[model samples]
Target: MSARVAVLGLGAMGLPMATALARIFDVVAFDIAAERVALAVEAGATGVGTVVEACLGTDVVVVGVRDGAQLDALVLGDGGVADSLPTGAVVVVTSTVGEAAVRAVAEALAARGIRCVDAPVSGGPVRAGTGDLLIMVGADDEALAAARPVLDALSSSLTVVGGIGAGQQLKTVNQLLCGIHTAAASEALALAHRLGLDLDACIEVLSQGAAASFMFADRGPRIAAQLRGETPPLRSRLDVIGKDMGIVGDLARQLKVATPVAAAAEQLYRTVAAAGLDASDDSVVATMLAKEPAW
Candidate 1:
């Protein structure tokens, strides 16, 4: 029989990942939002109301919460799934919470004979539904093998970085570049707009040349659209990127590394938040930079 998978936190990434997992496994999904749960059911997963209900009888529990606090609350805190999950069941953590947080949760779960797979994912929500994400894994051999099918189903490029906490570490590195590149893209596009360059053409040229980066390619059009006063759909949220950049900052501080450029980008995200765009798409940062200086 195929392994039964329980997916917790059916938000942007969770909903789509559960949809993909339902195609190959018996997937049970849970989210606080009733609408999201309904959407999960529409995608062929059995939607439950609580974490405990989702965990019971599952061979693997996949968590896609937003942060360490939510991860703790969902897995080990009040009304969490730690006790509900059977011994030897694997918990696949797909969030980008920092390495220390994952390590703490892993240790707690291991005490109950539950295996934890630190497998933080990238590639946004669209690729998640199509099972084409890039997954960075940090788990021992047995735990990795146990979660392999689910990981394979969700990832086009799955890399095992190290054992427990390493995936978060690698993802921190990823977010550092992502945060900086996004800030750079915003500034560049904002400058283009101020200089009377056609943003569409400029993005095309930059994306094909030495200035090309995944972030430039991915967020450039959205930045251009924002400069044109059009609201792009929220593909990546400012708050989420802000959270990731915060994680990068924390890691850099802990390791005593000087990342001046990333620090500047992090500050720009904060400025975007202060401008009352915290809840907006991250592309909105471009608008902030594109404005004429009052001085």
Candidate 2:
């Protein structure tokens, strides 16, 4: 029998994932923005108005919201998942809302006998569209078993980290590394420009050498474009990284760990966000770094 999936939040990541899920499941996608719902229809999902409508007859609910607060509002507020989704339905929280947030959501769902899975994803919208995402899932064995097929359809790599909220904790660490690598890439390329090296050659050579990383290979060309005054299409936005880095900051501070380099990278993203480039692709940090004063 084909599973019925309700996908909430039709943003960059959610739309693609919902579209992909529609291939294997009966999918009804919902978003507050009517325009986004229309887009989901074009992408193969059945679009709906209310979150409650999306939940009707669905066995699994996928949450791909922007942040913790958004997730909370959707699952806990008026007309929310807690009040709407039927008992025994599994709720997969794919938003990278850190540990505490996912934990609270999990606890709430458990109260109503709804299974919750903290399956925070990596890779951007493009990957989500093709089921090439890396999902770190945090759920007890029973919930994981119940949600496995749904997770299988969405991710190439699905690792069960531990009990509820562990996925977000791991994703937080990923953001720390990713933020630092992105910032480090920008810092390097900007320095190459300042040193009068042929930037084309610099990017080419650096990307081939031991200095190359996944972030460098992936974000290098875009960073190169930013250096030349061009804006690349976003795979992930500046404010997304800024927001993610902020999550990292919160987690690190709570753990009392010293993260000097990560802190510096977070500040760079914060600066870019404050300068009104929040909607710009995160590679714009290269431009910010290339400026005389940088950040």
CA RMSD of each candidate after superposition: 1.3, 1.9
Which residue pairs show backbone clashes in model 1?
none
User: Which residue pairs in candidate 2 collide?
Assistant: none
Compared with the true structure, all predictions reach lDDT values of 0.94, 0.89
Q: On residues 1-295, what C-alpha lDDT tens digit does candidate 1 reach at each position?
A: 3899999998879999999999999999999999999999999999998888898899999999989999998899867878799999999999999998999999999999999999999998889999999999999999999999999999999999999999999999999999999999999999999999999999999999999998999999999999999999888889889999999999999999999999999999998899889989999999988899899
- What is candidate 1's CA lDDT for residue 6? 93
The local distance difference test score of model 1 is: 0.94
| Model 1 bad stretches (over 4 Å) | none
Worst-scoring 10-residue span by lDDT in model 2: 286-295
Best model number under TM-score: 1
- What TM-score do all the candidates reach, one by one? 0.96, 0.94
lDDT (10s digit) by residue, model 2, range 1-295: 3888999998889999988888898889999999989988997789899988988878899998888899999999999999998899999999888899999999999999899999999887878999989999899988888788889999999899898988998999998999999999999989987787887888789888899887887788888888888877777788888889999999889989999999999999988888999998899888877789635
CA RMSD (A), model 2: 1.9
- Clashes (backbone N, CA, C under 3 Å), per candidate, total 0, 0
